[model samples]
Target: MSTKLHSAVEVGHLRKVRRLLTADGANLVNAGDGLAEETPLHLAARLGKADIAEILLDSGADPQLRCRCPFVNKFDMNNGRGDALHIAAAFGHASVIEVLLAACEPQAPDADGYFRLLDLTAMYGHVEALNLLLERCPMDVSVRSQALCFALEHAQIECARALISSGVDVTTPRRLYRPDGKGIRPLQFALSPYSDPCDDHILKTEEEALELVKLLVEAGADVNANATIAHRFGRYDGCDEVSILSCAAHYKLLKAANFLLASGADLNAKDEKGWTALHVAVASGNPENVRLFLDAGASHQVTWNICTVLDNDNYKFTKKWTALDVIGMCDTRILDLRVSLDWKKYTLIGDYTEVIELLVEDGADIEAKHETRYVGNTLLHSACSIANLSAPAGFKRSEFENGIICMNTTIQRLLPTVAAFVKAGANPNCLNRFHETPLHVLLSGVMNAIETVSGSYKYHHAYNWVEEEEKPSIQLLFQCICRTVRVLASAGADLN
Candidate 1:
């Protein structure tokens, strides 16, 4: 009898449904079918047969009755059970949803009930259903957050896009927690998604994703809003409490970075750690991203600013860092630049070759004095300091080899930068606060390496090189260093 009633409703046979719902079939109005164990009303709602739905509702259909069908969801957030309203929204049955809401009239769903409908609608990407729910159902900011995040995480771009123009703040994260104990966010995920879209079988094309971002900003998503959650996919580097713009730069999402800057994201807005978007771009070693930030009017001298950091032994000190300083600091790890110097203090390293070129081209403060933590170190001094800080004056076959390659490339670049600085009426021989000149710093490093080579200076690590392979590599490395010093000498450094 129940099977016949459900078939009648599924076929939209009003007369058959009415005939079955007579005194004999009245009890069958809420009977579960053998297939899905869903009541006749659930079938009507799922099929969007409003006429049939109204009959079921008028007879004895329970709008709040749950079906025992297993849900085919990836996350299983909704435990495989749904009511008529849930079934209607999941399939975008706007007309049938109206009937279900009418059936439940005079008793609007409580907060939890309203969101169940909204969540189901959003989860399935039914814009019409979502629109109707957003209209008839009242949602606070928290509800809006949950709805938007659910839409985003499920890759339901249309539903997520529709929710934006409905006055929901796009900057908010979902109230629901993921396995990581962190809530998913719209902008944060757009910048750095936790999983590939294909991992969930939701193919969100790049163009489609960009369109969603456009809708977000068009609806007043804060371009400078600090991310509620920092979802990182690559190397974990830098502080986590980063703004969206900084995160874009860190991930080298050039399109995102470009769009954010075009949308008027604050280029110099400092993150909690006081690193600007450009600072992150420089650290990420993406020359194009670095160029993007600078073209968007990132402060050429912002990296020259000092940030507070702790030193070894827990002493506090202020360090002046620059894009010039952070270049050549990447290896092995992903976008991570803050290398641990034996876990005492933090220093940045990345292969920022083209980034360095862009900075130089942007008229960076080549003669800037506040380039490093040491007092009054000029750009030249800090350039040498980075070489010393990373490689040090060591005499190991491999360490010395890596150190020379790094230092040689850096000073070689700085040599031309020095000429440009001198042409701009800046002094290459400018004295640091220690009264030591840039040339003095370079010479000290060369002397240390030479002394360590002759076994005069204290050095560790045995040279595991065969004599034949050692001599030529060492000679070539010195040639690279010599060529750089020769350029500095020609650039009017006080050779005396």
Candidate 2:
């Protein structure tokens, strides 16, 4: 009898549904289907039978009646627990949603407190259903805030606009906790390069993301709102008061960055750690964004800015690191400059070159010492150390020998970059706090690579000339290292 009513509701046979309800021995209006345990009204709501849903509701159908279906994926299960209102919201059945709201607790949420009925509609991009729910429902400020965040998280732009226009506070932080244990604002979420990994929604395209950002900004979201969550995670530096522009620079969100900048974001807003957006741009290896910040009055000479640095003993000191220092540390991580067959030929062709040239042209002190306790080295010292530091950990001498030819080619390819620093008047012979010159740093890296490879499995026994067969490859690597040493020496790097 329940199956018959479900079939009638599923097929939108309102007369049959009414007769089933009004008959002398009629099954209850809230009767569950056999397998899914979805009630008759659940079928009506799921199938968009508004009139049948009205019939069921009028005949005492329980709007708050939850189905007993097993949890499937998010879209399959209604907010991980099936309910008639959730079903109607998920299916965009506005009329059914209105009827359900009239009969049920309008403020009721699903099992997850974050997912209210409005959130379900926003998550599925059901704008009409969302509109009806928002207009007729009795949501408080917090639930409305969650609904807006849900819309933005799923890239439901129209729904987001609707929520914002409906007076949901644009500044309401997301209830979802970041690794930093703080809630992120809507602007921060929109500017983040990737959405939360656990979220089922894919990040929107750059244009749509930019549009969302513009919407929020136009709606009075603080453009310089600090992203404490990004700061704590320290993907960039753990500067606790990072702003939206800094976050945009860190993630290389080009369009969103431009929009923020053009929208009059603070150019030199420093985090609590004294790191600015420029510092973040340099650390993120985005020369273009770095240039953008500089063009907007970010200081090229804010070298004395200090961040808390911890030593090996876990003691902390305030240390000064310039953008140039950041650029030096970031240079070798540019994979194109390291892996290209013609990277040597085109050493000045990439973004690293652009950044170096920009810094040089902007009068950055090319000879500034990176004054950290570990190694107070110059730019040249940092660069040379970085060049030969690419050997994989625990690599065997045989593997190094087998790959010696390619290694030599890579060294040859990297020489032009070393030349660029020299041309920029980098003092190669400048000593670090440890009294080690750039030559010493470069040689130490090479010797470390050689030792790391040499201590691995022996390719020959004492009585075998297999050692002799391997000698030339080792010799070739040494020759390449010596040639690099000579190149540095020619640039005034001291051999002694």
Q: By TM-score, who's the top model here?
A: 2
Scored against the true structure, residue 454 in model 2 reaches a CA lDDT of 48
TM-score of each: 0.54, 0.68
Tens-digit lDDT track of model 1 for 112-179: 44436677677678889888878887777666666776676556888887777777777665533344
Residue-wise C-alpha lDDT for candidate 2, range 271-355, written one tens digit per residue: 6656677877765557888888878778876753443435357667665667666555413322221211211221222235566
Worst 10 residues of 2 by lDDT: 337-346
- What is residue 320's positional error in candidate 2, in angstroms? 0.9
The total number of steric clashes, by the backbone 3 Å criterion, in model 2 comes to 0
Model 2 residue 77 distance off true place after TM-score fit, in angstroms: 4.3
User: Candidate 2: where are CA atoms >4 Å away?
Assistant: 1-37, 58-60, 68-79, 175-182, 193-195, 199-201, 230-239, 303-316, 330-351, 380-496
What lDDT is reached at residue 203 by model 1?
Answer: 40
